[model samples]
Target: MKFKDYLHFLSYAKSLEELWSAHTEQMANFGFDKLIYGCTRFRTATSLGDPEDFVILTNHSQDYVDGFLRNGLYFHAPMLKWALHHEGAASWRLIGQMMQNETLSAEERRVYEFNARLGVTVGFTVSFTSVSERSKGAISLCASSGQTQDEIDAIWDEHGQDLLLMNNIAHLKILSLPYTAPNRVLTKRQREALEWVGDGKTTQDIALLMGLTSATVEKHLRLAREALSVETTAQAVLKASLHNQMFVMEA
Candidate 1:
């Protein structure tokens, strides 16, 4: 593959949309059928109405997008969460095949089923957070229908960080956009926890409701802080509630 060609186009991006548009076209030329792009605002002030906002720029059927929104599929996606939090990518088919071979336990089986029905076949999940805050990072890119793991790994080895940086640039672009109201940026989990926190729930109280531990809740808060460029949870929450970009994120 002409991986170097993408590097050439990378130089022409004057804005976030240009960068993503270029990257999307580059990926298709690289043989991917679909490319999903969305930057997550880790925390938002509650004043922003509604939750998360996602804009799909792919040619994939509307059915795929509608199904994704109707069921709120992004929150429950293990691979998506993993890619966003970690620094690497994985094979959905390998994971799915693992389940088929019974390498995973019952819970794993359930996750695989969910992804399978969602029309996901094979893909690579990769992430980059320019700042220390993971939420302030860019959406992990998943290049689907990759014929082999070698190709997928090569994609990561070459452009993984570049793609991540592109997403980060997109974040900055998002911040520059004018809005009638302030934006609230928060992750799906943080948004949910914030609503509960407003209700006066303890971390433990929130954990049980969200099916996570207090530790995990804290991790989300920490990431949210990093993304929001704030020093404390209180500051993060306050900002999240006000930004128009700070989407409610269907938690």
Candidate 2:
């Protein structure tokens, strides 16, 4: 698809799944058949927050994801390290250079070897510019198996700017959509209670608004806190707002 046409499609994407499906197909057209995109708003100096809170979209196999993310291999990924501290696109050749220079630790080498076994050897990582100190976003575009770094680099050399822009636009669009973490989706009632709370309603006020008893209002608030994994209703309101789950329009 043409660049302008793709931009228009991305801007109108109404959900993460729809946006990701189109994005993966576009990347595949450029020889990158595997893609992993991740964003976190809870990053800290020492960590990227709970994995559950991360917005991760990928087309990689479950096995690769199980090991790379579920097993915590991302903490030791060399390119992820670079992405944390830098912005813009970077070649996977840096991994080779790190190995040649013996700068890779044992754990990092283990991640490398694991990728090698899975044929996830060559790729480019695009680290997006963070909007805040506690936010980070990035995407890794892995070339199809049997493709070499040299060939991938040539492709990048010609069309890297366009690819980078598309990924950035996609990232921004994702942040605008509602995202609920796994096992943390708030029910309609839970969301309504939180929205009322956000609007400065007390328990009795919310009960009147929703035609429920004050006790039931408290129950909904309590469940909202639990679902968001927060300790209090105020925290639940903030977390829900951050994920764009409160007062959202129905589809």
Candidate 3:
């Protein structure tokens, strides 16, 4: 499809349902049988212990998806981990197994084989502007079998850039809407702390500048992470930057 058609279609994408509906047709046009775009809300790096972030899964067999969730497959899912920070588009050379070099683990192989047995192989994954370079949202398109890396790259080379741009626009527009979380607003100190981190300041440096202890600086950052509603210090910095909550310090 041409860029004009993409723009025309994207105008109708306000909510996840609308986005998925458009993608269903879009994927079919590109000749695929299954697709899914989902996110996980993590309170900490170790725990996906809460209700997962909003997930909009479609086009896959119900049994396939059910098995994925029941087995906790994501922990070893390489593409899922890669999407946490990298943006743009990419395709695995073969079944998700192609990543089996140093990039994957024994457990990752076990889980992937679980899917291979079910006939789902190879994938193309792209992110929709994550909350942090370490963590954010991702969308993935999977092929049942017999997909080439070149073909995948061709798809990305054709639509990947546009998809990235559109997802960014969609994310900003969503955050700007009235349904924003109440705790999004950070105290001046918290914002200051986070902003400094964004600027590459160390805890000790920020502490020296703010007349606080390294431990005290850590406290402010902890609060900042809570207010930002993201997990990980890296994600906090990224979120603050996304929301314009990151601060600037004078030379």
Candidate 4:
């Protein structure tokens, strides 16, 4: 596909799954058959977020995902370390540099070894530009099976700029789509109630605005809080916004 053609296709991705499939296919054309994209908005001083809340899109097998994500080994991943502290693409060769220079910690060595066992040894990590301190997004481009690190780097030397541009654009587009984990989806009425509250409307005002009784509006608000697992309306609004569930038009 032409460069602009891929960008056009990316813009039309209506869901995360569609985006993931399209992206992996494109990466495969460049000899990076496996792609993993992870983003989190709920990062804190000591934690990233609830695992379920992360926007994780990958083409890797379930076993790899289970070990890397579900097993929480991603926290120790060397690429993740570079991604958290910097924005831009970093070659996985940096891992080797760190290892040889004695900069790799024991835990990082274990993480690298774990990834190597999973055939995740050769890749480039792209850390997207950040707009918030608590939000982070990155994509790992893994060489196709049987490809060596030197071959991947040669491809990079040839098309690294184009690859980076594609990923950055894809990341921006993904951020614009509405997203929420299955367990946190809000009902139509629940979302309406939250939207009203987000606009600073009180219970009575929302009830009148939505043509519902105040009791029903309160119930919707209560359910919205329950669905979001938040204790108060403020937390509900924040959570809903974080999930991009607020003020989106249903199709």
Candidate 5:
């Protein structure tokens, strides 16, 4: 697809599913058949916050994701380390250089070996620039199996700027949309309670507004807290707002 056409589609996308589907297809056209995009707003010096809070989008196989993300292999990925420290596109040739120099740690080697076994060795990684110290976003574009790093690099030479621009746009658009893991989804009443809390409403006030008893309002608040994995009503409200879950208009 033309670059302008993709940008138009991206600008109008209203949901993560729609955005990700189009993104994966677009990347595949550039020989990157497998892609993993991840972002975290709660990063710290030691951690990327809770896994459940990450904005993760991918088109990789389930097995790959299970090993790379669910099994925590991403923590030791060499590209992840690179992404954390820098911005802009990088070649997977760096992984080979690290191997040749014997610079990889044991854990990092384990991740490399796993990817090599799965034909995930040839690819490029893009680290997006962020203004906030605690926020980071990146993507791994794994080339189709049998493609050499040289060929992938050539593709980058020809289309790198366009590819990078598309990914940056995708990342920004994703952050603007609302997303929550299935287990973190709040019920309608739970959302209502949090919205009221955000608006500085007391339990009795929310009860009157929603036509429910104070006890019922408290129950909804408690459930919202649990769903958001927060300890108190204030934290619940903050978490819900971050996920764009409260006071959203219905389509």
Candidate 6:
């Protein structure tokens, strides 16, 4: 598809699954047959947040993800370092550069060697613009098997601008979608209760509006707290809001 057509289709992605499929296909057209996109709002110096809370989408095999994401090997991934320190697009060749400079640790070298075995030797990383200090979003694109770095670089030289633009737009589009962690998903009633709490509604007021007893309203709030793993209603409200579950109109 043309660039403009792709942009139009991207804007209408209704769910994370649809967005991932569309993005994977688009990247494949550029010779990148494998893609992994991850984002987190809970990043800290010591943690990348709960894996359950991370928005991780990939087209790679389960074994690759198990070794990389599931097993926590991504922490030692060389490209991850580049993504953390840089904004915009960067070539995966940076991995070789760091290795050549003897800057890679043994664990980092192991991660690269593991990737090499799966033909993840050539690709590019795009670090998305973070809206908050604690948040980060990035994608790694891996060329198809047998496609060397030189060939991938040639494609980048010709279509780099277009690739960059598409990825940036996709990142922004994803941020606007409604999503919540699987383990933290609030039920419709729970979300509604939180929405009322976010709007400063008292339990009695919400009970009257929702046609439930104040005790039942309190029960819903309690369940919401449990689901979100928070200690209080206030924390539940804030956490629900962060997940785009509060104050959202039902479609």
User: Best by lDDT, which number?
Assistant: 2
Sorting all predicted structures by TM-score, with the top scorer first, yields 2, 5, 6, 4, 3, 1
Residue 176 of candidate 1: its Cα lDDT? 45
As a TM-score, model 6 comes out at 0.94
lDDT of 3 by residue, 12-75 (tens): 5455456556665666565455776655434366754333333335677878777665457865
RMSD of 2: 0.9
Report the error of model 2 at residue 1, Å.
Answer: 1.8
Model 1 global lDDT (CA atoms, 0 to 1)? 0.55
> Could you give the C-alpha RMSD of every candidate to the true structure, in order shown?
13.3, 0.9, 9.8, 1.7, 1.1, 1.6
Model 6, residue 177: distance off in Å is: 0.6
97 Cα displacement, candidate 1 (Å): 6.4
lDDT of 4 by residue, 150-201 (tens): 8999999999999999999999988888888758889999999999999999
Deviation from native of the Cα of residue 119 in model 6, angstroms: 2.1
TM-score of every candidate: 0.50, 0.98, 0.58, 0.93, 0.97, 0.94
Tens-digit lDDT track for model 1 on 54-166?
33344455766565534556544566556554653454555656656777656555555755675555566545443434243334344565356567667666766665554
Please give the lDDT score at residue 102 for candidate 1: 73
**Could you tally the backbone clashes for each prediction?**
27, 0, 3, 0, 0, 0
Q: TM-score of the candidate numbered 5?
A: 0.97
- Residue pairs in collision within model 6: none
Better of 1 and 2 by TM-score: 2
| Model 5: CA > 4 A from native | none
- Name the better of 4 and 6 by lDDT: 4
Sort by lDDT, top down from the best = 2, 5, 4, 6, 3, 1
| Tens-digit lDDT track of model 6 for 92-139 | 888889888998899999998999887788989999888887789999
**Higher-ranked by TM-score: 1 or 6:** 6
Better of 4 and 5 by lDDT: 5
